[model samples]
Target: MDRITPRQALRMVVIAATALCFLMPLYWLTISALRPEADIFRFLNPFGPWTLIPNQLTADNIVGLWSGSFSRAIVNSIVVALVTVIAGLMVCASAAFALAVIEFPGRGVVFTTMIVSFLIPFDAIAVPLYSIMRGFNLQNSYAGLVLPGIGNGLAVFLLRQFFQGIPKELREAAMVDGMGWFRIFWSIYLPLSRPALVSAALIMFIFQWQAYLWPLLIAPSNDMKVAAVALAQFSSAYNVSFGLIFAGAAFLSLIPMLIFVFFQQYFTSSVAATGSKE
Candidate 1:
């Protein structure tokens, strides 16, 4: 039997503490959402077990969310995120294929520009983008919500790296067999690059799912409001409902968390492959 050394025991303690620090917020949010509204902040000043574990749990907060515009917002967000993921994957994957497989002029420069574009905070360009959407008469529409997320730079970069990692010999052989670029990309590269595609899809889904400012700008009407934007409205209402806010946020977080958990293996592999290839 193996015995733990002092150093190994200390390392385990440190790891447990770090993980607790990361999970504490989520734990608090879950408890807050379950607790009675008045009790939500009762343990804040002198934190205790009650700070995380509520004395009484209620479904009212969660149930109340469905009674308001929040339910609509959730639906709108799901529709937008799904559309963004599907469209973004297609656009990003095609761009990646071009950058990775095709011989083209200024490809490096284009890729560099794409990388730099994502580095520039999206907020910086939000106003101009809002104006552009308005000009296209897409304001207060799903198209407005879905269009920006479809051109995700990071998704493109991730796919491009993964595409580059695929062996060139496969592409050459396919060409020798008289397969066209589109056919090769659709049939060969797409099938082999599932991990990268899942990673990129997660990226686009998260971008649209968590979107606030852009949705606020482009689709402010109650009918078109997204979950994040709706959550913000909760705090600003005449009587702020912290419990509802927490519940909505908890619900909002569950989808992405579940998605990453399910696809985490693929996401990790794709990222590691990109790092090695790069």
Candidate 2:
């Protein structure tokens, strides 16, 4: 029943303008994917003169991409992302539990060291990392791709902060009833920390899925390339099919969009839980 003030009206206009700025590129990409090659070149035409005939719409690019190595790249990306999430979550959870709940002589020192490691840029260490991979003959291997991302310090630190907020009384009660560390972790801490875990998993999955440079560096072969890497190849100078490139890019974008749409409630809850802890 309340009327809007001039300041509130101005704020609404600003928000709407910002949303349009962000969404315009995505709209353009979707339209480019749907349109034939001719329409794409006439993209500069205004809405009044640019007539988009329905008959021109074709799914040929999508079909062609599906039939090519893009399909296999999709499967590979899913496998790699899932593997990275599961492995990263398990390692981070265990490390976080130890850092948060368990006390040792040098526990604080160890935790500080882990936190500091987060500042060391991964790009700076790529040469040494590649040599280590070569020494193990892991180049162009799936294990090689998944292994390096499993122990991220950021994940460990985020989860550890959440773990530390859990009441000690509950953990002590579980211990008194003869529940060991693993049992307590699985039955109590993990179940209670679902929000944080989901948020962490989603973040890790997106990072791993969109990863271009590392995957390209480690796995150059078509058999091992991921969706992002495949997109780069699709856009290369020798093979420039704009429609196909747009289709592939749109398809790659859809996976993360679908993920966020489906799991956004959990993601929001996880972020809220983290804030609540603070």
Candidate 3:
């Protein structure tokens, strides 16, 4: 093995420091969630012993959150996120497949238009969107929550590029096998495109999971609140309990963390592959 060079040592130190900076917030959150409210507020040094080592550990706050509004909000979030994932995958993947593999007139223009649509931020269109949903009487409904945000241009772009990278020989071979377009897409490309699909699905899951503004605006009813909105409610409540709020937040974070951990291989590989050029 080669001896460690000073340059490599410096690079390693910089990378370690950067990673710690990113992780510090999560560490602090976890620490606060576990510790008692008195210790958290009393010991103010965020990076000090209080955060690094909690003197008083408590699960009551976490339990309270579960017993209170957190459960309902979590369920709502799950329903919305799952629907977004399923619908987003279907719409984005199908559009991506056609744009990537199937040739047609004005295809370039259509692709460019789709890509450009991402520049139109949702905040810019929120008023019009609300009016349309209101017109359809979709407010406070899951349909209102899931429908407007499901048109994911980024997913389509990513999956389309990945699909385009696939070898033409496969399509030619499928045609020789007497497979029609739909049969070829279903039997061959879809199966082979699992990585990109999973990446897109995971992306949408996380997006919808953390979705706050749209859900809050479109589905603000108590019964329809999601985890993100509920978090705000925790803060806005008359008796603000930081311990319980942190506990709830830490618990809420687990779903996405667990998702990324479980499917990390798929997520990373697919993202890298999608970005890779032919």
TM-scores for the candidates: 0.88, 0.88, 0.88
The alpha-carbon RMSD values of the candidates against the true structure, listed in the order shown, are: 3.3, 3.1, 3.2
* Candidate 2 structure, TM-score to reference: 0.88
Q: Tens-digit lDDT track for model 2 on 1-278?
A: 29999999999999999998997777677767787865676745666444433336788878887998889988888899999999999998999999999887899898888888778877677778888998999988899889877888888888999999999999999999999999999999999888778877876887788688888888888898888888888777496888888888888788888988888887677678799999
Candidate 1 clash pair list: none
Note the Cα lDDT for every prediction shown: 0.90, 0.83, 0.84
Worst 10 residues of 2 by lDDT: 47-56
Give the per-residue lDDT digits (tens) of candidate 3, residues 1-278. 28989999999999999999998778778888888787777877655665577788887777877888778888988888889988888898888889999989989998998889887887678878888989999998989988865788888998998899899999999899899988988888889888788878877786787677888789889888888998988899999989888987887777887887888887677678787855
On lDDT, the candidate that comes out on top is 1
Q: What is candidate 2's CA lDDT for residue 80?
A: 93
Instruction: Please report, as a residue range, the 10-residue window in candidate 3 with the lowest summed lDDT.
Output: 44-53
Candidate 2: where are CA atoms >4 Å away?
1-10, 45-55, 267-278
Candidate 1 lDDT over 1-278, as tens digits, reads 29999999999999999999998898889888888888998877697877777899999999998997799999999999998888889999999999999999999998998899899899789999999889999999999999888888899899999999999999999999999999999999999988778878878887887788899999999999999999998999999999899999999988888887888787677679799998
After superposition, candidate 1 runs with Cα above 4 Å error: 1-6, 105-113, 267-278
Q: What is the lDDT of residue 194 in candidate 2?
A: 83
